[model samples]
Target: MAPLHSKSHTSLGSRKSSIFNFIQQPPQPDVYYVGVDVGTGSARACIIDTNGIILGLSERPITRHELKANFITQNSTEIWNAICYCVKNCIRESGVDPEDVFGIGFDATCSLVAINEKTDEPMAVGPDFTDHKENIILWMDHRSVDETIEINSSGDKSLKYVGGQMSIEMELPKMKWLKHNMPGGINSCKFYDLADFLTHKATGSEARSYCSTVCKQGLVPPGVDGSTTGWSKEFLLSLDLEELVEDDFRRLGGIPDKNGTFLSAGDIVGKLTAKSAEELGLSTECIVGSGVIDAYAGWIGTVAGKVDNPTVSNKLDSKNNGTILTSCGRLAAVAGTSTCHIAMTKEPCFVQGVWGPYKDVMAKDYWLAEGGQSCTGALLAHVLAIHPASNELSHLAEASNLSKFDYLNLILENLVVDNKSRSVVSLAKHMFFYGDFHGNRSPIADPKMRASIIGQSMDSSVNDLAIQYFGACEFIAQQTRQIVEEMEKGGHEIDCIFMSGGQCRNGLLMRLLADCTGLPIVIPRYIDAAVVFGSAILGAVAAEEAVQEHIHKKGKSRRSSILETQRSQTSLNKVGSGVQLGDGQHSPYTAPTATASTTNMATLAYASTQTGSHHQFPTMTPMTEETDYFNQPPQKKPFSDEDDSEDEQTLSFGSKSNVQKGLSQKLGNLSLKPLTKTTDTSPGAKLWKVMEKMTGPGKVILPSDENHPDRKLLNAKYKIFLEQCYKQQEYRDLVDGVEAENIKG
Candidate 1:
């Protein structure tokens, strides 16, 4: 591996060629895998062997120019040029013939790119569009504050899916801002997110990833009732940017597809046309994959599956505990310039201040909710680089022969050790850092907020550097805790924390996370290269090849597969018996491995519509006659002929301490708390019914304070969430219900 710090500031050197050692000849000989990742400053390329090893790696810096205080922009032509350079470098380094390369995949930051497909020219974004081709909007850009407020105020149903609010960082706000401010550019342009643009440019395909549209843009996936739609025509018309709803909504991304299902990347998307081939210095046969957002690629690479540890020998005993335990349950913070916390759920959840429940966005059949801060490590660097003590620290680091980050960490470590009474983890207690410096991305998608530092002193020495460093780390962890807390309130119960990205390597930061969240942190063995491997897997899958199989060791099968092999001879353990899935709902047909009885047949309520309908009951081995409900109606008749799926949230309560234990210790105390009492029957049932009446179809769930403890706590917490977390019309309605009840009484 190369040293942590690059010797020179320019580009990666000839070591790129040595990476070819990992390249494997494909079974079909013509098949290959490509992985592309776009970071805050550049786009990188990697070629991986079929076994998921890096064969070749290359990179080219992307051009990002700042126009104003918070405005960041990039040139599409420049980005494409960088991509071409990296691809050519990869082919040259690996010495792999382009024709032998079969599939390719890509992922980039969720930036916005605009172009005129007919003229194939860029449209202006601001007064500084001199490059004409510099029409791309960087993810870090935050110039549409008012636009975000307007969209949030409209209380669009699509907004609820994105945690009940909209932000300027997302594409719709930017699009609306563009149309209202620059009518000419809006008229002349066809809009595409940065990832969508790269894929379209490479393959001449317009398909968008559900990952991008559902997460960042206001594209709602098909719900349980099976209705699908994009930005509302009426809403856009009301906003006076109705032209976007024209052309059947071609400008923004159309119906989005799952990641890795589109045209494969390695096989010639369209043989590199002569013009493009000449510029890229590659054979016409080079293939390109449908690209993805950078963070999603990280999700594809690191946490998709196949993570194993020999030291972790114990298996979870409870049926339901195993699924959440075995799965990577930690918040994955893709920390670099910014930090994003990605959490997954078996069912789709609409958190009031979180990002998604985006369908099939990353892992197929799973929903994802992304919470994050706009800045973390990058903000720290930017702040420290300008500090007066930085010059002194740099001089000291040069003398000590250490990188600046290492130097700062060492100092903080010494201080923590000397004090003995305090730990670096507790630094945020004395000092707090507001997330608004780059703006908050989650728990509040408010961009108008600015970063603030509390408990600063006039000390301009090395200790100042240590304090700032410790403070920054603490601030990030607190922000992360806040996000996790919000997710829990929205009904997501996460246990461990999984970390990736370069920043995850920092021991201080990891310990800080552990201290704040009080959860064990799992850092995957392959950290930096996870995204590359993930994209390669996506490419492999798109090419009609099996990639999930590559996640395990050569002779080892995945947990599901292993269970299948043994199930015929011995009774297999069913998921969710001793373990809780929130509400009291359990799959009766599930077999238990421990001191529990197996239900005769499966009847699972509260399961996601997508997976529950088609999932086959897990068969326990040693076939015995048991009643099968596969084709039978449910045992219980309808209590009320009403669909209460929205109110069907179950509360699975694992002790806070249980989350910190090892597998065996953790599995000992699993308890199920089913808050299954229907609000329709409770005293608060009438109040909830009244509140339901106040809400219209396609409206959001709101809080009301009319009833006793249960309803009052719900409304108060929800009111605080809306007033302090994220505001929407639904929140106002909830508050209005509280007032209306007080007067009536």
Candidate 2:
């Protein structure tokens, strides 16, 4: 019952400095941005200046109702109110004039929100359709499994973009579920992705973000799915959800003659409505930028972060014609309730069981592949909650003035020291956990997959709970490794992971992830608030565009026009002159010379090979290795080998075949080496300037030494991690086989 001790006890607190400390000193009269992020449990808002330093932040928790198992719903009205409260509080905290905040951006979960088109009031989507407040179908809700399966059975080509089938969580399936279950169907209602809904609430604009529609609503970007229109109308009709396609998909943000004006992330939606402005304690002059799904916001906030490590930065910085191409090697893993693994590629890489290969979702002219685990943080919480010793652990943690995770981590570290183990990885060497409790979202995209525990006992003690927690953390790391390998197979050569959200604070999870995957993890400066900062970045981009428009309309010099329009706004200070304006005129703002057209030839060649390919990749054969590990029982000292010399060994789990070798080789070839070119005075160049100034660097967690004994331990555990996945399938097959025989008899 003694207070546990570890070096990591103060690590999280020390790293989590106040955002105010990083704010620009002696606040200038510059335009500000309010970034609002509506997460699963809370609505958070932050105020950031032109330099992208967060000045103030506030958060308010929203209520969610789990009416039934896997039937989660929330009140849209409550969410909006929480957002408004957070925004107002953040503004008050920052002491910035409301008039000075020129732009606002919102990002939320990819949940579905329903409202009556006529009344503009919430409409219920839950079991009791009368209570209109419970209108939102949470992104994690799995009530539409049957509908999802039905839609997938149509064999629609649109399904290909969503990893061969639609998820139960997407809008279409939820819509279908609502259509079948709701009393009057969906004719009286309009649906919005949560992010789009927030923008609509703020600006009264029906504009949808490409980030929301392309990623969730199955709107394949134009030209990718061979459709002139973004929507697949034929696919909709096949599913008997033609109401969505009616009026040019009016309910889903499609305009009549104009089709739908799906703006890319950061595109200006409109100025805030008077009502919204008053409610949020802001001015109507605040332009609303198009919103992105929360994970994509994490991508925006983290991928462009400056790398402080020269060796890593030099390796990642492959610039062709002054364009920064470091994003290709960086995968943004936005880990919170669930973890979304997003990687950008020059061309669409169709990895089976991974969502996307969708264009223009997060960045311009780039394809994004999204893989995820449906539950990570939630899974860890579940593990703790269900265990018998959880209460004792909690009491001890509280007594020591530490969080449950910190307490558990301290216990783990102490165990390593006391047992003289190699590292924390060896703590759970006897116990392996497969955390697919909520379902697997990537590689093997099965929703029915259940969790497995290889070596659990009836030991109801706090020490047992800590080891279980360690195993759960190991599960998260191993799954990440699997997801990365799957992405690599699909043609992405990810060398580092840029992480955001609450999980970034978990030093144990971060270290495990790096060691498990053998990839350096870059932690953003804002940590928990990175997604909101990304939303703030959107606001900055929108503000820049809005300023340019004002200048062009006024027909005055750019600087004078901006100053007059913004009242006290100064010219962009970081990059001066040689920047392209919105109307093809040169501006005082400077940016990189890399134009969108200045792409690497090697990248182009790689895309050429995958031009018409579906989810096909080169056949990868298994690695040739001794089967001794699988043949023997689990070892207590997996790291204790006579060959444990400090010789560097690459800790790879899967095949070392030609395909694996080719992935690394192809990635190297695709490195965008610098090419000298004339300065690009294009409109896109100016946007790049905004991005460079706004995106800042953060603390970096390098992968554990490759020669460390823990590397071998993790590599071995990862194999057990993968084997358990197949073991679950084998168990399922056994049960299914007996059921089939019984039914036949």
TM-score of each: 0.64, 0.78
For candidate 2, write residues 257-319 as lDDT tens digits.
286778877888998886888788876778888899988888888887665454566566654
Clashes of 1: 23
Tell me the deviation in Å of residue 231 in model 1: 4.0
Error of 2 at 551 (Å): 10
lDDT of 2 at 140: 77
Q: Residue 473's C-alpha lDDT in candidate 2?
A: 82
lDDT by residue for model 1 (1-745), tens: 0111112111222212221112211222223466666666666666644334344666656678786777788888877777777766665555455434445666777888878757867876764755576687777688888888898899767776777787667888888778877756487778877876776676666667666676787766555324445456777777777767766666775443322222212222343344554555533334454556777665545442221221111221121232322333545666556667777676776776678777656544567788888777666666677778877876775566444544566565455555652434333245544435755677766655566666777888886777787666666766776788788887777665556554544545554564455444554323454555556555554543222232223213242353345446554111111112222322111111100111111121111111221111122222112221111221121111111111011000111111111111011000121112222332212212211111110100111124433233323333333333334434656888999999999
Predicted structure with the largest lDDT when compared to the true one: 2
Model 2 residue 187 distance off true place after TM-score fit, in angstroms: 1.9
Judging by TM-score against the true structure, name the best candidate: 2
